[model samples]
Target: MPLMRIQLDSDRQTARRVVELHRTGKVHRESRDAARAEVWRRGRTPAGETVFVGTTNGEPVRLIYDVEVYRDVTA
Candidate 1:
């Protein structure tokens, strides 16, 4: 899908984390793809947090929402 093409330098950390999640089976490839698509379109996570990613236009974009985390946080 076409994206807005924006700078996503800050999202590098989140992208790395997403990759780790996929590698460890915490998240599926489909999910990651969807997330990326959303980041490109919405320019953020669902919660309105900034996100970054490589764009379809070969540029970075700022995400406009927060990604959902299913991992245990009470530890």
Candidate 2:
């Protein structure tokens, strides 16, 4: 699977919410528009920023906030 890295600069609350939603399987619900938007995992940087890891699966998806995005080629 292709991995994606989403870095939330300063929005810790949103990042926490995203992680929680994914943990509860709400983000992967088929009834939602973001059906393919599944957060595989999450972590924190040394600087205290929240980072989310997910897969594109070749489908387009959107995030809640305007943040930096990168393709995790190493994964």
Would you list the C-alpha lDDT of every candidate in the order shown? 0.42, 0.36
Per-residue lDDT of candidate 1, residues 1-75 (tens digit): 123333333254565565566456565354345555655475443333223332222235232223542233355
Q: Report the C-alpha lDDT of model 2 over 1-75, residue by residue, as the tens digit.
A: 233344323244444566578677655233122222323233311222223353232223333322232434454
In model 1, which runs have C-alpha deviations exceeding 4 angstroms?
1-10, 28-75
Model 1 TM-score on a 0 to 1 scale? 0.29
List TM-scores for all candidates, in order.
0.29, 0.29
Find the candidate with the highest lDDT and give its number.
1
Candidate 2 lDDT trough over 10 residues, lowest sum: 28-37
Identify the runs in model 2 with alpha carbons over 4 angstroms from their true place. Answer: 1-10, 28-75
- The Cα error of candidate 1 at residue 53, in Å, is 13
